[model samples]
Target: MATKPDIVTLEALDAFDALIDARSPSEYAEDHLPGAVSCPVLDDDQRRLVGTLYKQRGPFEARRIGGVWVARNIARHVEAWMQDKPAHWRPLVYCWRGGQRSGSFVLWLRQIGWAAAQLQGGYKAYRRWVVQQLAELPPRLAWRVLAGPTGSGKTRLLHALAAAGAQVLDLEGLARHRGSILGAWPDGQPQPSQKAFDTALVAALRRLDPARPVWVEAESRKIGLVQLPEALHQALQQAPRVQLQVPFEARLALVLQDYAWLGRDPQALARRLQALRGLQPGEVLQRWQVWARQGRLPELFADLMTRHYDPLYQRHLRADDARATMLVLPGLDEATLAQAAAQLLAGGLARVGS
Candidate 1:
């Protein structure tokens, strides 16, 4: 007699053939197991109606209605699974918890002579593991901070370093913000919640060897609206920094290149620039607004860099005593910038003197 495979434990989940999330679409969308695919057992409308029935009627009546829906959904998934399943496929199915939903699916799979396992404690268990990993990251690894002034191309440099085979963590990229007042992208996507941020950071760290250097951008504790995990923030504070420098004109050009989309909505650009009000004095703010209206974008950006951005950067530099490594780019051309980044990262440049 053949025996069925039991449900998977958290540690063994990564090796599972497939991770089927059997929660409703809405439930799945709210948050889910990191790599699980949605093969919902109940659609959103059906799930809501069942919930209402369960509250309004007796448990038996609710279960009877739910059972019909669940069986239909399971049959569809099973057919799909059969088409996709390989001979060696050993699926791990789960729902909100290792409850009736997953149990029913697992039983059906077993009856059909397919080897499928449920996830013990389901998605909730995975969330717990993610939280634990992130909360304890500081004690497990050392980080290297890559700090730079505004428009210094830190994010782009991080990507360049990654292409050169260095381990890099792009914090702003993950947060979906460029880390400035005008940094929001056209999509206006909000960053993931702090819990979600920690989950992602921990996952990135897991891929790297802790003994090796990992590069991350120098940033404030908050990137736009998302606050960094405290443990990782503390690790960043202690990490040694490699500072980058570019000529003011080059930086201005880089800023323009970064925000090239702004050319289409000069009014929106003006508004975003105006958002910096009260941070600077009224006269300085008005002057910048005039430059913006006159369409002197380069001059406007230069003024902001000198009067607002650079001063804030200087303060952080004084506090950190960062080891500034100057890699001067001749121009903002992609090739020139990439070459300059490569030279610095490849240890081809002399160390900058204070």
Candidate 2:
């Protein structure tokens, strides 16, 4: 006879052959296990309908209606999504809280002689582990902070550093954001949920060598919609720093190059400029808006830098203990960045005076 499904902790996830997520699609979109497949038993609409039924008619009626919905969806999922399962395929299943959803899925899988287990405390347990990691992980890292004005090639430099075999934890890249008011990518991809950000952050941090310095850009505590974990943010604030000093005109050129997509639509550029109104004087803001409306990107960028980005950047600099190194470059071109990366790799902290 087949036995009941075994229960497993979040720590034993690797022992299973596969991890299956049975939460609603909307829930999965927010975040899930790093490799968990979405095999939702109830889609978003069905979940809302079932929830409403439970509130009005009670759990009996809710289950009566929801049971059919869940059964139908699960059958379809097995035939279409899980048809390749081998006889010995053992999967770990989880939902929001290891409740009826995961319990029911594990029951169905076991009846067919598959070895399946429900995660104890479900995704919530995994979330707790992530929290513990964020608190503990940053301390283990040997951090080297990169700071510069808005248009400085901080992110690009991080990419170059990683490519040169340096250990790097790119928090902004993991967040899918550029870490500013215009931080959103031009193509309109949404930033990952906070949990998703943290999950990816922890994974990235674990991959780095604690013995070597982990390179990161200086960002505010919050990057776009998600905030950095408190411990990591604090570590960043106190880490030894490197400042990149690209020439003002060259920095403007770099900013235009990096954000060139924003200049494609004059009106769209104007709309973005409006965000700086409160920070800039009325006349300065008006001129900037007009410059944007006319697609005068260089002039608009210059004005924004002098009137906005430069001044605001000072606030960030004030928080730094003192920069360990200042790499002044003629520009932020590929050659300059490569040289800077080499210096970082070969010099270590002693190169600060150079």
Candidate 3:
């Protein structure tokens, strides 16, 4: 007699040797549990074909056809992917809603003498857990918001703090955006889907100790296309802030270094600047584009800082950060930022958290 496969909930996930996502490749690509390996029981096309058959020919015909395809795929996986598994290997498998794909896979693995289990409610259950934890976790931990104008190197400082052994949550880093209109990564890496971002965020949060204050950059509710969960955004807003004050020239130099790709691909920079078109006068916008086309980046960057970014910062960011503890830095070089980070870890920023 075959041993019955176990069904496990979210809490039991870590006990397994491997996490297998049995959903289609496309579904796995969109979002999945952190550290899950894609071992789809049905390929994207196969899943589509099976669903269409179910709709057109009724459940009986669909199952008859689908079972053959599923059996062949499972055998292929066992041969190609699981051949090296030891006798005692245990794996957790999940599909969209703890349904047929994962159930069948777990059944086969159990018959083969491995301890395999299906996720109780599959990816949907994991997603719900992510949402609930995100809603609840941010409130319990203390947040330290880093408030600074554009080009002030908030992200760099976050890195510096992390290197100095401080608890840091770089939301923009996780979102794959810099939290600005021009914030798309220069390397052309696409941002993760909102679901993926949430997964990454929660995983990062889970790693941190709640007893320590988490330092995060002050950001708008949305970072590129991903919105911070409401609880987190609220916690960040309510947290004490550390204001960074850098001189205009230092900021300009930092921007030039950070966005050096803008200088190399001025046309790309010109196109991105178009996002600010409605806000800036047509002539001003036209001139900026012309400067971009001409490769006159320093002048274009300075104008953008003085005219566009500065005004917006004054109007928006300055209000709530009025009482913030100010750290006036002379430069944004790595050594300088590292020194500042060290001081912060030395309890320079403790009062604000308190």
Give the per-residue lDDT digits (tens) of candidate 1, residues 1-354: 433357777777778777888898877776677787888878999888888998999778878999999999999987775676766777788988788888888888777766888888887887788777777766577676767788877778778778777788888877888888878865557777665666677777788787877888888888887787778888888776677766787788889887777666666677777788779998888887777766778888888899899998887674645355545545556665567556756666633221
Q: Write the per-residue lDDT of candidate 3 for residues 1-354, one digit (tens) a residue.
A: 543449878888889999999999999999999889998888999888889999999989888988988888889889987999999999999999999999999999999999999998999999999999999999999898888889998989899999988999999889998888878877788999999999999999998898999999999999999999999998998998888888899899888887787677878878988999799999999999999999988899899989988888788874667788888788888888998888777767422211
- Stretches off by above 4 angstroms in model 2 are 1-5, 319-323, 348-354
Candidate closest to the true structure, highest lDDT: 3
For model 2, residues 1-354, the per-residue Cα lDDT tens digits are 543348888767899999999999999989999899999999999999999999999999999999999999888888986789898999999999889999889999999888999998888888999999999999888898888898888988898898888888888888888887777877778898998999998889888888899899988988899999999988987888888777798888888888888878888878877887677788988988888888898888887788778988886575443646877666777776777788888874332224
CA lDDT of each prediction against the hidden true structure: 0.77, 0.85, 0.88
Model 1 stretches with alpha carbons more than 4 Å out: 1-5, 86-88, 188-190, 193-196, 270-296, 322-354
Tell me each candidate's TM-score: 0.84, 0.94, 0.94
Error of 3 at 149 (Å): 0.6
Q: Which regions of candidate 3 are displaced past 4 Å?
A: 1-5, 349-354
Worst 10 residues of 2 by lDDT: 345-354
Supply the global lDDT for candidate 3: 0.88
Candidates 2 and 3 compared by lDDT, better number = 3
